[model samples]
Target: MIKQTIAATAIATASAAVSAAPLTLEVFNPGEAAIFPVASVLVKGQQDAVLIDAQFSRGEAQKLVQQIKASGKRLTTVYVSHGDPDFYFGLDVIKAAFPDAKIIATPGTIAAMEKKAAAKVAYWGPILKQHAPQSIVMPQALQGDTIKLEGESLKIEGLTGATPDRTFVWIPAIKAVAGGVVLFNGLHVWTADTQTVESRKQWLSTLDRIAALKPATVVPGHFAPGVAMTPDSIAYTADYLRKFETAISQSADSAALIAAMKTAYPAAGLESALAISAKVAKGEMKW
Candidate 1:
């Protein structure tokens, strides 16, 4: 159930980025920026469509819009998933094409965007004025834990195990789960320099949350569309944290821990975890 996301997944891969019917998801790839957990598209009939995540750049965002138009879906709304700029910033370009679509994000995401917007207005204001056009609407409908939209009910809740903003959406009708950031498979478990110390233990328990759903298809936040949610996605990331933490706590140095881990999993994000390891070595990383 765990697919290899090597160069085999086709780097810089572009597959029209569109769906054929009831719904098809695609990988905007985004090249070096961030891979995996592309975008999630839901097409219900011709007049109803919803997208989760706009991807990183203006180009991918345009393609996503085209994909929706190609499906003849009326591009109703987009769920930001979280406030990571790579995930949400492209909403600016997206709105130019689909002017009426609204974004659905948690309170955290909304506040983050507003703060960023304010920062752009105050300090980076010139950059915002020159290149970043702010047109996408602020997220609404805190919707707390769940939201019923267009016959599709999305339950939004954070899994303490992943990042604090981690969210998962459950579609009971299809037995499908869109675990935004909580569970990631075949890609770096983290990209945004998350607070991973204590999140490690919580990450393990979060798997229990996804497992409780017993989903058939799991939609990861970064890469492609996924099925086989359970241990395939959750367990892998948890295992990494567990092993890394154990080794570090045992006074393993950064080089030793990274070498052992890299040998075990060629794709282990050792480069990504270097800063983390240094912190652990210095006792700077909290448990």
Candidate 2:
């Protein structure tokens, strides 16, 4: 009986080893000219892979599609974190490349997309001009809180604060977290939706939840190339939110607020995000 048990255990161990495939995480940063450094991470297994976010605009998405193809892995899934146009606008490009890949997002995210799809398209149309996608490709509603690939499964946690709805993906095997738009590494986060004090507080609470994950590596939605996506991404975002709130309270005018923030984060380009936040704060623009 003891010999039989030992033989069974060895067989199981061997099977597990054969099924385990090495996974690699790579970030594709769409550098300058992009309002922010939108990062798309490719979580590649030996046979298949998953993409974190589609990208912000036409050019970025085109570059990302090429990067994915270069990876030489079958793309099975593209998980969108939120309804934000930047994350999904380039989805069509990816779909064209991997015809079988399913774009999935939470129901709430889909709703938000439906709510803002037209508005976002109008907003970006003039900016992107001919580079814009002819039409948006909405994501299919994710069935559950996890994405199951062949030999691996990624846990998804729906979160709010950064946006009306955002999803974070946790990969246990790699001890990594794809934080979507909830975290920003070395970039000024979009505060247009959180102009009020209450909204900013909620944003802080959301950051706390992500921090609790203790991810060894974090893939922030917007991050500069070569920047390490560690737990510091969460800290940086939290600190920026607090500073933005303080700047709002202390600055005498919109220009003053923008100046103060720029002075604080000189290297953090993309003044467009700050302009949007200022417009929203002054009641000049919708939240």
Candidate 3:
């Protein structure tokens, strides 16, 4: 009787382990319509969900809130992957909707957000107008590199690298990546921020690190509509950066650089990004 009881307990434990649900991901982006096509991913477990980055405009964040409500999962945390305004400017809406959600980000990211949030708002306010956030909701500094959803771990990578502020999330259970500023897809890769050659090189290295992980799902922070969220985006971004570098060295002015990139990526969207990035790269405009 004792032997039979032990066998039953072991079998039950194995069954429970096999039946445990995996975390699922849902991504929301405003596509090319709203300024930047920033992606916000909702990582849902059995009972809880975690949001990665908030959208740029208040209206878009409201849309994201509707999606979360539709998911029927309680949101526990909202993790801002980068310090860019487009990533967290809509946090005000998110906070209002899920007031209990713990908004968090890497310490470096938090610092950057704090430093630039006001200036960014001043610059973009006129353009966004009605869709602009009435106020900013700052995220608390994340204590560690890991965020837990259910029993699974969402690891924040690239913290110790050259660009600690620019990090991505690695969800091991799902073998997925939520790439931040380091990755772009179906759009002209933003180079205005990483104007220095070394900075661009570090960005490339970050992409390679992500590629090494071989994630089944890869979500680019900024991508055009209909672009597949896959490893192919990584390749597209890296190649664009290389081409931009070549164009910068060959061209004498921002116009030439812009022409070169447009020729290289005729189908890519976000010409505004390419124009500004080319100007910054050619030293014709300060970003």
lDDT, candidate 3, equals 0.82
lDDT of 2 by residue, 6-110 (tens): 111121111001112356787776565465346677888887889888877777788788778887889999988878887888887888878899998888889
- Which of 2 and 3 is ahead in lDDT? 3
TM-score of each: 0.73, 0.85, 0.91
Q: State the local distance difference test value for candidate 2.
A: 0.73
- Report every candidate's CA lDDT: 0.55, 0.73, 0.82
Candidate 1 lDDT tens digits, 223-267: 422223333665666675666666566645656755655655675
Q: Give the winner by TM-score: 2 or 3.
A: 3
Q: Candidate 2: where are CA atoms >4 Å away? A: 1-21, 33-36, 159-164
Query: How much is the lDDT of residue 61 in candidate 2?
Result: 83
TM-score, cand. 3: 0.91
- Give stretches of model 3 more than 4 Å off: 1-21
